[model samples]
Target: MSSRPKAKPHFRVSPAVLGPLGIEQLQDPALAVLELIKNSWDADAKRVKIVVDQRKAPGKILVNDDGHGMALAEFKERWLVIGASYKRALEKSEGGRPLIGEKGLGRLASFALGNTITIQSARESGRSFLADVNWEELSSAASLEEYEVKIRRGAVTNGTRVEIHDLKGAWSSDHTEFLVAHAEFLASVPGERFHISFKVDGKAYRVKHALATINRLAEGSLEMRVAPDGTPTIRKCVINGADEKRIVFRDMKSDELDPTLAGTRLSLKFFRRDEAARRLSGVLQRNEVTEVLERYQGIRVFRDGINVPPYGLNRDDWAGLEQQRTSTGGPTLVPGNSQLVGELHVSKRAQPHLVITAGRSGFADQAAVNALAKYVRWTVRALGTARRAEHLGISEANVRVPARIDEGKDRPRTASPQTIRAALTAISRSEVVRANPALRKKLEDASQAITETLGQSEESLRLYAQLASTGIAATSFSHELRAEFDVVSEAIAEVAASSRKPDKELIDLLSTSWGRILAFAALFKVVPVKIRRHRKTMSVSELRSSAETILGLASPDKVTTELTIPAMRLSIVPAEVDSILLNLVSNSVKAVAESTNRESGRIRVRFEAHGNDLAIHVADNGCGISRSVAQIMFEPLEGKFAEGTGMGLPIVRYIAERYKGAAAIVRPPASGFATEFVVTLRNVVQ
Candidate 1:
């Protein structure tokens, strides 16, 4: 190698480099305007006004701000320098506001909006100055330094004004509306000291903070705080004007979490977009509320009372809420972006690791960002859990009725005319009633009438319960028998194909299928009668055996079953338990079979006992239930699949309620399973 003395050469930048560094760096014209506003904010501006005039060709836009304007020398040193980092060393402005613009490139954002820019500023105690720049001239120059900005003396003023001409795009009403909407949210909090006004063609556009309006009508509100150690605790949760119990999340102490996510506070307000919720809001029109939510429903991050761009914008799922809800099959158990408006508060000086991206669109991809997302998700989930519990409590309270008195008996008894008459007669003998004989007679007559009405109601309730039970049983039996019949039919068809003698495998398959049919028939026979008898306790192994038998008949050969039963006995009747398992497994089988891309089906059954309550979770890797379907899946004849009788889940729910428990579609466990159903049986574990 003939290596002479290597020459060190410096790279030369072309005037065309401004295209990529300035004009092309920002794609959206509105964002360019936003960058200018941010510069005003960093200058500690209290009032800024933007005027867009399109009455003539090549519209002119003016941005005026009343702030601490720059002196000529200061402007030449900072504003003229490309890629300046002076703001990087400063934490706050002279007015004690946190600095927002640091890269010094935001000034170039004006070139994205127009071809020419004129800036005029006057400092309180320094000389006023004016600077004019033509972007087209700069881009065509031989070198970046060959272009010169014309600087001259300007009228004395206390603030700055930027005049941009030769607009790139036609200005319209929609652009003004976008400015109003986005500018309203820039302050992080509504009605802050920083004020922004917009005027289009001499018409002032009013800025309404939609988030503030929605917050007042929110159905629920939650506030949480995260400690430096990564422990999160709910400070307050109010749902439907009632304070809910607090929820706590485990500490996140990973290497990427603890250092960056300390001392963050989050506040969220929930709005349910439904007619009932709208009626409760009292003043909200359906269309008006919908429009508001569509615009402002997301979680935003704020650093020192100023919003970080693009985090809470429309359709921005920075926290992965939609992904979480889809993975868990839990729209009710997890809140999506459209359901909440939240604010996350962080400090620039405190959490420097949470750096903003180069384009100012969002936070950089870092561990700190992941930690923040995780904490926000946890907060949202806690809110959902509290709201769900509140709903369940309300449902239970609505269905409960006061106990009726019986003749000299402390226990509650069924309503009857004789019992009512006896109780009213005792009341009539009181001194106040004796004094008013006519009133006493009225009371006695009313009691008899009330008792008769209640008795009819009770009879109707009994009939309804019987009908529901019978329907569930019939549906379950049909589902199981169909599977067995299919197995038997397949075995017989195989035997017929041999044409010589029945193979051993085919004979064994037919016998097993027959045995399953008999077992299922016996199980069905005991369902209605065994519910009335004293419940017999069964060991964990016995329950597993029952589940295995049902799974074997319900699942096809390609389907696999996973059981995670703890070593505990349950004080539940075997028949009732069998019915619950039979319906759940059969539904899973159908769901798996209905899936378009079926390889090998998987079903998981897990049991956990908390005190005397047993929680059974049945999950499957199948064609998952949609949120709309899950909402009404427990209702009779409301199934998503065509072959579903829709009575299976209703039956499972009915049996659980008989034992003073509940059945629900819960968030799927984190085992890659979809569509999970939870059946809770109270006082059943021993």
Candidate 2:
């Protein structure tokens, strides 16, 4: 009696709700145009023409395609229906073309460009259906059926034409350029003859599919092609404008089989900033170079020749180029999002799992996307390394040394204690010594003071270098910590915003962040401890083993490292040994990663005793150091590689000199190694 009836509410949505949100979702006009093109593709159109007529009043955008069009009944059931899964129902068109349009919302994107849209479609039956939409009417409609959409039956011959009128805004030059550049992707379908011609103000420009050939404006470029079976062939192209030479590399892994690299063929071009390079690139004027850079800037992902949005956009660093540079603590010559221009060619047929998102901003958030990102990041680094080497050879105006010490005949030399003692002894038995005994004693005391000062001076220089190295290391450490902290902070904030209870995701995030923090803490503990004067007995094998272990912990698991040292003791500071080993290993790792010939790289370290000194040889099978870098390998300057802070080799030299040792580059004794560095250290009594 108390509970006579329970009330139930039915939820209803207005069709006009999407009128505003759909327009807002199309934040990019280029993306809106791309959506229309995708729709044409999904319709199995073999030839599509886009005519941009802005010279006249109101302006107009007409997209005409020769494809299997729609009938009146089908148009009412699917075309006019919002969020219809008609494409998804069949999965493929009648002509066997994969349905590129998933979300029905793409059709609504027309509202972002113009106030009026007319869709005319026809099947192979030589008859057509026409439907016209007034966006204003749809927005003010009280109900879905209230808006009047003009529809006609058997209006035209077999084909589809979309006419957008009353342009919302003017299309800028950048928009046109975007369309021109993206045409290559749109026309890239294999074994299919698809043409997309663009016409503006009665002028026409046809987009070409140029994936099979490359036209790059750089000093050097690396092109990598991976087959479906995971076989890779690498070609290094040296472009001196019209004179281009290509060197093909064989027997390299290329990491094509990696989960992230599956079904992706990479083409990475390296650019140079030198005047010579700019001139060679046919950029005669500064403005011309600017235009070229503007047209071909950023890394783009092309799926079956269609440019996927957001990946290569100005602000999108899908390849993590900036993060990789930051991780290396230096300016990446590997090209940031704004500097490098290339394409990650993927095929929908080959990589079905790499699904595009409904928003069209990028691929869906999944492991495959992450893998693609990782592979791209690695390729960027590799290209940057190669380009940096090429850039070093470009002559500069100033031929001065990077570093100089003031020690010449023109500069007065400071007298040392030994020089003063020798002078005094020369006059000790002479009349000057007898005439002024007090003077002789004063001279001897001054000599002792001078010797102490010189000792202090040496110590000061050593400390200065150590402090400089530490300052650099500290800056990098802080950057890494800040990045980790950002993740942790985000996770904590997410957990706090939860409904008063932590879910499994929140717990996992907390655990992961905490683990990363702990790992960094452990890594920080191994930062080389400066112990210039503190000599300790250390086993060569033990030092190498410890350094390798620390390197293994810090480095990515892909790098292969091997340590070869006899269990012999050396009377030197353990920290210095660690510093030497660490720097060399780090350099080797970078070289290996950058090498196109050796995708999966290896570093080998061997220790040998030479008389009263220890010669530690560190080698790698990476892209070898150029002659220019080799000549100044230990010159106490930043090495001429992109992945370096210009301090790694210098640090090695600094530590070597402190131990009365020397670090030098030598020819590798074997074929397996690309570059070899020998560090000689003096053996002392501990």
Instruction: List the global CA lDDT of all models.
Output: 0.68, 0.60
lDDT tens digits by residue: candidate 1, 1-686: 98798888967667677666766767567778888888888787888998888789789889899889888888888888877858899888888787788777788788888999999887883567899999888888887677888999877787788999999877755566556667876654543578888888889976657765687678888898877666777888888887664433333446434545677889998875542233442333544665677577778888876778777765466776644443332324556666778889898787887777657767785566667778888888777766665664432322321111121346343445565445434544556555656655644444444344434323332332344336533234443233343444333333334442432323333343444444443343334343523578798787877777667644455678888898898887776787788788878877887664255888888899899899998888888888888889888656555334456788888889988999998775447777888999999887
lDDT of 2 at 598: 44
- lDDT, candidate 2, residue 470? 53
Q: What is the number of residue pairs that collide in model 2?
A: 3
Instruction: Tell me the TM-score of model 1.
Output: 0.55
Task: Return the TM-score for each candidate structure.
Answer: 0.55, 0.48
Per residue, candidate 2 scores C-alpha lDDT tens digits across 1-686 of 58778778955557667755466777566667877888888888889999889898799888889878777778788877778757666656778765677668788778888989998888885678778898877777776666778987655587789999998888766677677766656677666677898888888876875433234445456666655555554544443432122222223345535543455777765443222122442324433444455445557887766678766654355555544544443323444544456778887667767777767768885667666766666566555544433344422223321111221325333344465344434433345444657645643443343244332322332333344345322212222233333334334333334432432322323333343344333433344344333666776555755666545633445667777776577787665666677667766766776665344777888888766678888888887877876777666433544324455677777777876888888765456888888988786422
Q: Ten residues in a row with the worst lDDT in model 1?
A: 398-407
> Please, what's the RMSD in Å of model 2?
23.7
Clashes of each: 0, 3
Q: How many clashing pairs in candidate 1?
A: 0
